[model samples]
Target: MKRLPNFVQLKEVGPRDGLQNEKKWISTADKIAWINMLSESGVKEIEFTSFVNPKMIPALSDAREVGKQIKREPGVLYSALVPNMKGLEFALDAGIDAASVFMSASETHNQKNINKTIDATYPVLDKVIREAKQAGKLVTGYVSTVFDCPYEGKINPDQVLRVCENLFASGVDDLSLGDTIGTAVPTQVEQLLEVLMKHYPKEKLILHFHDTRGMAIANIMTAMHYGINRFDSTVGGLGGCPYAPGAAGNVATNDVLYLLHGLGIETGIEEKKIQDAGLFIQSKLGKILPSRSLAYFANAQ
Candidate 1:
C-alpha cells in the first residue's frame, strides 16, 4: 500500500474562484465578512478576490475595496487573481501577498476564455509573473483544463507539461493544475503526475479539481499516492467556469478536510470552522451548497 502524506495544505478560493461564477452579485461587505471568517479557520492561504475589470466580472468588481477592507489575519496569506499588468498593479496596490495568473492547456479553450491564443496568453502571463516578482509578491501559475476541456475534448498531457514548464521558467513560486470541467479520472491523474513529478517538486504543485463528475476525491487520492500535498478548494463548492458549460463548482473544502482527517493527514483546519463558513455563504447566497459533508452537518444540526 502506498503511504499517504503526514500533512496537506489547502488554499481556500471561495472568495475569488468560488464567487466569480455566481450570477448573483455578492455585496462587498459580504465578501469581506466571508474572507475574515475564512481567515479565522486556520487556512494558510486564501484567494480573496480577482483584479479584473468590474465590467467583466461584476461579482468581484469590488476587488480593490474587498482587498483593502479585509482584516488581515496573521499567518494567513491573502492572494488575488491577475489577468494582466493592470490587474497586477491593482493587486500590488491592494498589498496582496500573492498574485495568480491563469491560462488553459487547450488552445480553443484558452481562446474562448481569454479571447487570446495560447501563445499570446503566455507573454502576458510571463510579464505578470515578472512584475509580480519585482513587487515582492509570491506568484502562482494556474494551468486550467489540465484534465479535459469543454471545447477540445481530451487535452494532451504533453501540452500540460509544456505550460507548466513555461510557468516555472517565468519564475512562478507555485503551479496549480486545474480539472476545469472535472472530466479527469484517477488513471489519467496518476499518469500525468507520473510525468509532472519527474520535473517539478511535489511541494510546488497544487491540484485544483472540480467535482463535476464526482471524481474529485478519487483524483486527489491518486495525486496523494504521488506525494502531491497541496490542493485548491472552495468553501461550499461555490464556483464554476463561466466559459465551460456544464462545469460545476470546485471540490468542497469541507469534503477535502473530511477525507484528509479520516486518512490521518493533518490540514490544520477545523472542520466546524469550515462548516460555519460554508453555511454562512450558503445562507447569504440563498442557495443550498452541494457539499456532502456540509449537507451532513446541516442534517445533524
Candidate 2:
C-alpha cells in the first residue's frame, strides 16, 4: 500500500464556483463576509469570484466589490476567475492576488461552456496568462471534464494531455484538472495520473473533484496514491456544473477535511471554523447543503 501524504494543500472555491451556479441571488455583502470568514480558516488560497460578464453569471455580478471589500487576511492568497483580458482587468482593479482561467478538455463542452472551440480558447487563455504574469500574479489553468464530459462521454486521456500541455506551455503556473461531471472512478484516475505524471511533477497539478456519483473521495485517494497533494473543493458542497446536466457540486471541503484528518494528514485548517463558514452560507441559501460532515455536525448539535 502506498503511504498517504503527511500534509495536503487545499484551495477553497466556494465564493466563485460555489455561488456561480446558484439561482438565488446571494447578496454581495454576504459573499464578502463569507469570504472573510474563509480567509481566517487557515486556508492559504481562495477563489473569491469571477470577473465574467454579469449577464453570463449574475450571481457574481458584484465581483469587483466583493473582491475589493473583503477583509483580506495575511498569508491568504485571493484569486478570481478571468475569462479574457477584460475580465483580468477587472480582477486586477479588484486587487486579485491570482488569476484562474479555465477551458474544458471536451471540444463540445468547451464550446458550450466558453462559447469557443478548444483551439480558439487557447489563444484567449494564453493572452490572459501572459497579462496576468506581467502583472505579477500567479495563474491557474482549470481543465474541466478531465475525466468525463456530459456531452462527449469519457474523455480520452490524450485529449486531456493535449490540453494540459497547451496550458502549461501557455505559462500557467499551476493546472487544475477537474472531474466536471464527477463520473471518474479510482481505476480511471490511476490510468490518467500515470499519463499526466509522466510529463508534469505532482507539485504543478491540483485535482478538482465534484462528488456527483460519490466517487470523488475514492478518486482523490487514488490521486494521493500518485503523490498529488493539492485539491480544490467548495465549502458545504456549494457548487454544481452549470453546463453539465445532472452533475452535482464540488466535493465539500468539510468532507475532505474529515478524510484528511482521519488519516492523520495535516492541512493547517480548523474543521470547526470551516463548519461555521458552511453554516453561514447554508443560512444564506436557506437550504441544508449536501455535505455529509456539515449535515452530521448540524444534526449532532
Candidate 3:
C-alpha cells in the first residue's frame, strides 16, 4: 500500500467562489460573520472574496468592505482572488495575507471567462505576481479548467503543464489546478498528477475540484495517493463556475474533512464547527446545501 500523508490542508473558498455565482447579493455583515465562523473551524486558509470589477461579478461587490471588516483570526491566512493589477490593488488595500491570480488553460475558456486570450492573460498575472511578491505577500496561481472546459472539453495535460510552469516562472509561490467543471475522473487525475509531479513539487500544488459529476471525492483520493496534501473546498458545497455553464458546487469542506478524519488523516478541522458554518450559510442563502455529510449531520440534530 502506498503511504498516505499524515496531514492535509484545507482552504475554505466559500466566501469567494461559493458566493460569486449566486444571483442574490450576500450582505457584507453576513459575509464577515460566515468568514469569522470559518476562521474558528481550524481551516488554515479562507479565500474571503475576489477583488474584481463589481460589474463583472456584482455578487461580491462588497469585497472591499468584507476584507476590511472581517475579523481576522490569529492563525488563518486570508486570501483574495485578483484578476489583474486593479484587482491586486484592491486586495493590497484590503490587506490580504495572500493574493491568487487566475487564468484558464484552454484558450476558448480563457477568452470566455476573462475576455482575454491565454497569452494576454499571463502578462497581467505576471505583473500581479511580481507586485504581490514585492509587497511581501504570498501569491497563488490558479490554472482553471485544468481537467476539462465547458467551451472546449478535455484539456491536454501538456497545456496544463505549460500554464503551471509559466505561473512558477512568474514567481507564484503556490499553484492550484482547478477541475473547473468537475469533469475529472480518478484515472485522469492520476495520469495528470503523474505528469505534473515531474516538473513541480507536490507540496506547492493544490487541487480544486467541483462535484458536478459526483467524482470530487474519488479524484481527491487519487491525488492523495500521489502525495498531494492541500485541497480547496467550499463550505456547504456552495459554488458553481459562472463562466463554465452547468458546472456544480465545489466539493464541500465538511465532507472532505469527514473523509480525511475517517482515513486517519489530520486536517485539524472540526467537522461539527464546519457543519454549523454550512448550516449558517445555507440558511442565509435560502437554499439547501449539497454536502451529503452536512445534510446527514443536520438531519441527525
Question: Top model by lDDT, which number?
Answer: 2
Error of 1 at 164 (Å): 0.9
Error of 1 at 119 (Å): 1.2
Flag the better candidate by lDDT, 1 or 2: 2
Of models 2 and 3, which has the larger lDDT? Answer: 2
* Model 2 segments more than 4 A misplaced: 241-247
Per-residue lDDT tens digits for candidate 2, residues 108-212, read 999999999999999999999999999999999999999899998999989999999999999999999999887899998998899999999999999999998
Give me candidate 1's TM-score against the actual structure: 0.97
lDDT of 3 by residue, 1-301 (tens): 5788999999999999899989867788888998999999999999999998989889999998999999989989999999888898999999899999999999999999899988888888899999999999999999999988898888889999999888999999999999998889998898889889998889999999999999999899989999999999999888965455545699999889989999999998998899999999988877777899988998998
* Cα lDDT for residue 192, candidate 1: 83
Q: What is the C-alpha lDDT of each candidate?
A: 0.91, 0.93, 0.91
What are the TM-scores, per candidate, against the unseen true structure? 0.97, 0.97, 0.97
Off by over 4 Å in 3: 241-247
Model 1 residue 198 CA deviation (Å) reads 1.1
Q: In model 3, what are the clashing residue pairs, if there are any?
A: none
Residues 1-301 of candidate 1 have per-residue lDDT tens digits of 5899999999999998899878878888888999999999999999999998878888899999999999999999999999999999889988899999999999999999999999898899999999899988999999999978998898888899999998999999989999988889999998788888888899889999989888999999999998999999999888865455545689999999999999999999999999999999988877777788998998899
